[model samples]
Target: MTLNRRQAIAATAALFAAARAATPRGAFAQSPTTPEVRKAVLGYIALTDAAPLIIAKEKGIFAKYGLPDVEVSKQASWGATRDNIVLGGERGGIDGAHILSPLPYLIHTGRVTQNNQPVPMVLLARLNTNGQAISVAEKHKPLGARLDASPLRRAMNRESKFAMTFRGGTHDLWIRYWLAAGGIDPDGDVQTIVVPPPQMVANMKVNTMDAFCVGEPWNDQLVNQRIGYSALVTGELWRDHPEKALGMRADWVERHPRATEALTAAVIEAQRWCDADANKPEMCSIIGRRAWFNVPVPDILPRSQGNIDYGDGRRVENFPLRMKFWRDHASYPFPSHDLWFLTEDIRWGVLPSNTDAKALIAQVNREGIWRAAAERAGVPASEMPSGPSRGRETFFDGKVFDPEDPAAYLASLTIKKLAGA
Candidate 1:
């Protein structure tokens, strides 16, 4: 469910032009009004959590602010999402789109497919966090029950197939990392494939894919349909992990300063509105409608409202850190988050051993851009984060993560990395 869709849209629509205009007349600290952003193009994965963008668009947020012609397109993959912004270079055309957190970093460090080409990307704000989950079908319930048992070794030796949206981002990385971290070789343990988000459930039903990692409402849909049960919530692996961000080319930030700030301010407004529990039902309706995820409202309802139904009887309501849209200064883009991805890249051998990887991590993330946006949005200036954003967010369980000491964390784990530190 989403909060205040209409109000947020109207507020956003009015802000861009008003921000540029009224402030010029000493309306705000005698600073000049920012120039209006004419238009924007955003890439999205067509899921429920993308409600903010969909609602803002449907309610005319972009148009309200005089960016009436904002273009929202459905992108094919996370790789495409990055390419359109990074390697597609500085598009003097559209603003940006829904980018996964680790993607821009990977692109910058030449870690994944888009390596070598430096893409200057900054997070406008965090759109949604922690909407993703891994699901195994009802028939696989026995497998799901055994998921956390037996150290996952039995599953690995059985020649099972694991599926995900793509090879580059979180789903792939986590699947590989979890397997390797737990002493299973991803190559020999399980066969994997790239199945689009919409097809995850269908594939599961038909037995085409065994266990799949994907975003909601698909996971919820799989559960609601009794096709699958939850195995591992991402939080089970890494808690309070930053997921998606609104990405723009750094050149875009430099070219249209006012427009970027306006966009940032608008997203923050939308996030605050969406975060409220009261707003979720309506938000879900707006996003679950055909133009968005197109799933029924009920499927999106529980999850968006922080209710977790992992098929059968595993149901949890209001998980403490379950998919925060507006908590933890939820919008701040911390550098340590970037560093951790670099560390993961190094761990996986995706990034070369000798690259000044830390320097590269610093350069690509839009730390400066996010800080300025938070201030303009009236969030505490001191609230802005720096360095690695990963931290010890205690879960409903007693465990905690200190990204500060991943090596120790990794070392202490009973599982071993295939290639050792």
Candidate 2:
């Protein structure tokens, strides 16, 4: 006797409700301290990584934790997500967003948006990890451009342009690192442009860009459309690499602390639901609806189930390191991960060469808030790390990143545009 995905989800929801009802009044369920519950207008792009936010709203997780009026709206692009967050909920915009991991630091430092008017923001938790890829146009297949980007050098020499979602965001960093590792300078070797995730396949159809890096189901959609093939999944570049986060204005969090806790707890629970294998099929169906992604379920389900078809006659079933929402403490906002993002921004000359990485990480990463919410949500104490760092991480290229000495790591990079390096 086996239960289908929908049945499993129903069973899980029932168990969750029963547990809440059985608990004492003051134990697992407690009323929020904030009397006036404001609508939590949150923004998301049409990527599969936006699952936790969508699930929280659709499955009543937000309401369960006191954010009954939460509205998860879809944004047109990462750039739109950034501008709306800067404007905040009062000015016909969002209070927070499912954003690129580096965005909070970029906004806090005033490197992007306005005339250096820093938007003070806080990263409450990481949303998802490692479901992005570097995809090349189908024409490049003849050039033998799989993981070895050396073939791109020829195209770069001929005025080839590449696309990424944001200028100093995760997709940008992934493409830059991949190209640089192949001895090609992203700054000098190719022209890069910003194209939103949903538009990637359409743009490539018209030869808008030679290659691009973005989150799914766009990457998988490229294969379905027969326009391109994934040269490398970002997880192959750096396993379990942090991708997106739950970010909000620092002022908003301060004004509604209890609401903030509720929001974080709901997202954490949503992430847990998204990570469960049994819920993945339904998760894909929910997010693939016309109102959300406007994409078909076939385009979305493959990657969600760890099925990878590179569209070049290559496929891998049950690939272990696909997009992750909660397992491996994926939701924890490690300060070290923030530091790595800042370091990459500096490497690409996106941030000032003299920026103090440690102080900025401490100021912007609200892991304390995440811990409070996790504890309130009854996350096992053993799941939380004893310290801020996730320790040293190694990349597929065999290079190690030690968060303790970011400067040394920066200094050792062979390809960089750091101001005085």
Candidate 3:
């Protein structure tokens, strides 16, 4: 109490030091306004589902959330995205990507990685839902394959090549589901090939593929070019089905938890912006830029606006179930949705039949991170989901997948490539 000026200063400094010591180290780094790193390299394929990441970058949403130097680079294919994510940003690759929801699980389990090496990854958020399509070449247009693949079953054989982006990705799952619903065996009766999203229209033009399942604007482009007709938009198969997701290297996320939240928040905001009906034209124009998809607005806007010209003498204007980015809780990374992907992968022999889906989902899904980021993005509490599961989901073919009992759903399927079958 009677200390001199120097003594008082020393006592104050000591008190401050003690306070800092008492505070947890993570508390200081977890501030939403400050990130450990300002730059993060994120990859995206030239697909409409990637619109959120592109919008986040172009609209300065990332800068709004303390990440200004973030790079939204276009990846060539899902395979390339996987490879780059494995390389990470420091090695001239990416820290994250607009990826298939199942890809992170596959990579995390080393099922899709090189030499069976697991590259741990985190599912931060779902980029969008219900915008992908299964297209059939003009040659098969006469077969009249709509929601039912039975029409095309006559045309399918081992030589019939169907294309998807990656081995266990969403496209593969969708096409497989469609064929199976119509009693067409995807593995035994037809061949499924891998083709990049941007190359889909070109491949169809040359008859390189009999059909393909991919995200826009390829499906719309195929119709516009008269190369093929859409057998069905994936939404028709399963309305509001989860598609692309925002996934990151777990190491990068662990190294920069604050940055991870900021990145996710930015994307969430961009998703809201992208979902607005009024922003359709502007959003399409931005994504169609030469620096991005290099696609014309005509090719990208129709289906995105819920308008579709099936090219098989069927056109639906203002279709109710189209692409959803933020509305209907589209951006939430639901653990139940991830479980569906893992379960389907197992059904197709992509993941082992014995895989513990719930445990694996717990390991790879970052729904907690998504909730935090959603709050950071100023999402109103009312807009947030009350629970992780969306309850039981019903597909167009009348197959119901109850998240509570995936075993029953799997066992119900008549056609499957389960392990050792």
Candidate 4:
């Protein structure tokens, strides 16, 4: 009963092994695949949804699956993440990144980088879904600001600027969708600029931006700091909307297929762990460490636990559709979602009207790789959806986006900066 540290560790390991053996097949046991390379450097931003990668690195899931040297380092900003990932692991940056869902497509298509030279990146898995928000500064609340941009529109002038992490990224799209739905043209009605997520609250404090759309802690932090109010949660826009992704260079994935599989399996395991309500408190504590998010546990834990304080006299004690790391097939990179991102980029004139969306999705989405990793992890086949599409997704506005008819979806949009429009 009074064993030394080593003996206690051994006993715990034995128990873990026994549990894995007794569990149903595909319940996230260690995979048989051995990685070709042991060392990998990955990138993350300071957001709660970065949980899967952080959990993988912290929980020794990487080492359990033969990727002991996987490093999950924090990046200064999403732009830095893009640039460093482009630099690759050999150049002292990163091999891959926990990236914005649309970023892999943007990188592959040469939209976000210098010289417009495409980077052939492959999406390994989606990291999380939902749990992002658009917050309006306190100044706009006096103008009766709410989810609908109507009051905010009355207060807007040419000088009003909105902030999002990246111009063509997820936050941008969310804010644009929200504003456009409320009869505000994100492009023509106001100026929009880029501000990193961590700096969103700081920027709002200085009156640099009227509003911003970003991932957790920052939006929650703003409400804590008394500078802004949450206008809407992104999940309310579209439940279980795909958010971040785990992406690596196509060359890297090609050179080390086994390594990629190992990495995916480890991350999938981590996602499942993070999604468990029981593990949320520990997950928050770990990610809140200064080396990771550099935010307090108080700020981080509330949102992770689905306790949202909108900081505008509105609160949801048990908000449905909070950040999901694994549930609802969140890890699977649905090609249909990829198509939606592409079409939205085209709608905003970020991609050409003539771009072949289907061909590009095939080139970038590595769903097959994800499936292989799932099988290796012993994920039951029943959990995996039968097709590449999640089918028609309906949004808060009651608009349906049929992946099969993205062109029709695009044509139906009232506010668009479509190419040649």
If scored against the real structure, what TM-score would every candidate get?
Answer: 0.80, 0.91, 0.93, 0.91
Give the range of the ten consecutive residues with the poorest summed lDDT in model 1.
Answer: 412-421
- For 1-421, candidate 2 gives per-residue lDDT tens digits of 8999999999999999998888875465345444246478999999999999999999999988878899999999988998898899989999999999999888887879889789999999999988999999998887777667887777665377789999999999999998888888888888888998888999999997899999999989999989999999999999999999999999888888889988999999999999999999999999999889988999999988889999888899989889999988789998899889989999998988988889898888999999999988889988887888889988877778999888888887899998542
Clashing pairs in 2: none
What would the C-alpha RMSD of candidate 3 be, to one decimal place? 3.9
Over the stretch 47-130, how does candidate 3's per-residue lDDT look in tens digits? Answer: 999999999999999999989999999898999999999999999999999999999999998898899999999999999989
Per lDDT, the best of the predicted structures is 3
lDDT of 4 at 211: 93
Candidate 1 ranges with C-alpha deviation above 4 Å: 1-31, 63-66, 86-95, 110-116, 144-152, 380-421
- Across residues 1-421, which tens digit of lDDT does each residue of candidate 1 receive? 5549898898788898777785556345323435355566777886665666776677766664445666777776665675666534335433578766667666554445433666566556667667778777576576544234234455445467778776556676666655655556666566768887787888888888767888788888888888878776666666666677777776767787777776666666667678888888888888877766778999888877778887757778887646777776666666666556555555555555454545775566666666665576677645555444645544322334356665554344343233322
* 1-421 per-residue lDDT for model 4 (tens digits): 6999999999999999999899986648435576878879999999998988998999899998888999998899999999998899999889999999999888888888899989999998999999999999997787765666778878887788989999789999999998888888998999889999999999999999999999998999999999999988898999999999999999999999999998999998899899999999999999999889889899988888889998889889878779998888988999999899889999999888998989998998999999998887778888787889999999887778999899889988999997752
Shift in Å, residue 212, candidate 2: 0.3
